[model samples]
Target: MPCLPHELIAWKILVRLPTKSLLQLRCVCKAWRDIISGADPSFSQAHLDHLHQQVKKPYSLLIAPRIKSESDMEDPRDTRRPWADMKVTSPGLYLWEESQKDIATLLFDISSFPAEGAATRHGLTHCDGLVFLPAEDTVRVLNPATRQIRVLPWSLNSVAPRRCPQGEGHQAFGFGRDHRSNAYKVARFFHRETRGMGGLGMEVFTIGKDQCWRETAVQPPYPFVAGLTATFFKGSLIWTIDYYSPMYDYSHLDDAANMPCFVRFNLEDESFSVMTGPPWYKGPTILTPTLPR
Candidate 1:
């Protein structure tokens, strides 16, 4: 009976620790490993919830392209190789903490990239605690706090053509959670045709599942701004559809294609719905809607 009580106490104490610590503890023993295995359905949600709570104290910002100024000081996100002769620029992250403003706020050490051994680019889409990085031919998802990284398989969007008819073969990626399946998914929208960009195709890749890119039956009503990234909210992926209205600009639309709005693709049904956009904005517009994490 004494042994049973002590074992129960240890388990209880273990669950309450930070998930990173729990992951390291898994290697301690078989019994401890099973306590936090991914096979256990409840483990993931509890771990994510705990992480969500912990990161809130010091809010994390998901930045893209470049967030820091260039200076003579040593920078970890230098795009050039160690022995390179020319200059290259890579995406870098800056963290904001209320109490720690005096110290430098970069996430990784000054000499390391986000993924230690990989090519670095300047595009990232963020959802939940993970930031999804897109390179020329690959996609990587990183959990900033836990130091976890996942590289996705090649998909339709990965191999984009050199030139596109509509707007230079633009592709946008979305990452989000599906509550119904309790799975995280990466969504890609791009033109599949080599010569034409008439309409975009949608493909989904579920994390931890050995599934190929599953094509969706639906496509966006208006052409997507090839450069814009998708925003995640309420189990849906949102993006600003870039199209000029006939009433305002005669080049992009007629009576047939009047206007398009901010659009959302529901992760569950693999379908899209047009949402209200800005009443007035001259340049390319993106709807900024806030959803609780």
Candidate 2:
């Protein structure tokens, strides 16, 4: 029997396997290991391209189920807070497929990197098959297919005032890739005090490079809606504009100026731009990706 050529094995056959399987097969031989995990990125890029072309339907759902900590179970005070039961021993991600409606498989767990205080489960942000899970003050980036995880540095807002009115001091986070540098970044928008004045500030952290969060000179035009995820598209993270608040100056506008808008932050330039929202649109709006025709 004749064996296939090196090019056929690397590009044609290996590129079609799932990430998890490829990672495991890396140990089978030196050639396979180099092709699967090496300094050169051509093979990996080809694999990603193949995966994208093969995906026709969105059947995968990343789920992080909330589990109560042992301390919460011992306390019979009956806490009514929603996140009271969010902390647990080992939080995990479950993948639900449309074909297997009743069965959800556990992909990985994050018990190794627990939050400092009570852990709050947030929605998972998916970018190029990577999952970004942001907790209270820590963020975890996970590759569900390979079960590899990275816990980012702690993000703190030290300059924020100790107390503020409700809905005034809000913090929102975003995760996206910078196309120019081909690096992934995590962005945080929070309330900060500068020169005895209150305003919204932003800080960014580059994964696999930055040791700490670097504060960006440019600030957000408007505060972000709390508990809403930012949409990543075309090298930018976009969020629905929150209503004008006293924290930032709004004296330049009248009552009619208050309306729904979009604040786009370019990951490459680290700048913000205000885009007008749909006219006569009412209620909440979530930014989502549309299939290209």
Candidate 3:
């Protein structure tokens, strides 16, 4: 009998294999590679949706070693350990061992977060095979299995804004993907000084393109907020403002709230909106992407 069609065979094999196997099999052939790479949105979305439904309960969690600051290291008797654990229900963190430099592709296993004799110097945030490190202004995108790190070009000065003489404030950085463009983007939210003073300015940098940053038209009304936390979902950037109102004055009382609200910036239309959260949920945290079950 003749061999089964490549797509058919691939689909059959993919259904039985784990997420890691499917990721690795993407490198097996050109056709298989394209399919798994999400070049075809419909199929990719379907596969992602199926996987989401299959693992609705809980699979694994990503754990990273906590960073030790100079203030926390004053005690001479303190000892350092190699591993850290964090409970995660979604597939977010990716691991790439430094030792396996050349062939380091992204690992999907939480257990693989701290493999035998692996260094835990850098924490990882995964999007595709890309690993983002926020402790510094730089990002490292690598495939641990292939040990290939595509260091995209960026300006050091652009990322670190100049300090205002009056000590006004600084901006916050967030990284996420734009599904419509199928590109990864880094967004910066700057604080404005006053009304008509350009309340909030957003600069977005897309991956695989020349070093170019585009600014958005929407601006936040309040200028008192100190920090911004952003995440990408459904082709837009969602930002969370974390602010502490000074007791000195109540000028910003109109904008003050106990919980942060979701501020969305649509990449396709370049628009902004204030989004309300679930009725039962409370507190502020980075919004992570979740595949629907």
Clash count for each candidate, listed in order shown: 0, 0, 14
In candidate 1, the residue pairs with backbone N, CA or C atoms under 3 Å apart (3 or more residues apart, or in different chains) clash, namely none
Q: Report the lDDT of model 3 for residue 232.
A: 58
Candidate 1 wrong stretches, greater than 4 Å:
4-11, 50-56, 62-94, 104-122, 156-161, 166-169, 194-198, 244-258, 281-293
lDDT of 1 by residue, 111-151 (tens): 23432212223246676666787654567787766566788
Residue 289 miss distance in model 1 (angstroms): 6.8
Candidate 1 lDDT at 148 equals 68
Q: What's the C-alpha lDDT at position 224 in model 2?
A: 71
Leading candidate by TM-score: 2
Judged by whole-model lDDT over C-alpha atoms, candidate 3 comes out at: 0.49
Q: Which of candidates 2 and 3 reaches a greater lDDT?
A: 2
Please provide, for model 3 over 123-210, each residue's C-alpha lDDT reduced to its tens digit, 9 standing for 90 to 100.
3445543555432234445444334555544533332323421232345555666666656776655544432344446666776664
> How well does candidate 1 match the true structure, expressed as C-alpha RMSD?
6.4
Error of 2 at 271 (Å): 2.4
Q: TM-score, each model?
A: 0.71, 0.79, 0.56
The models' CA-based lDDT, in order, is 0.61, 0.69, 0.49
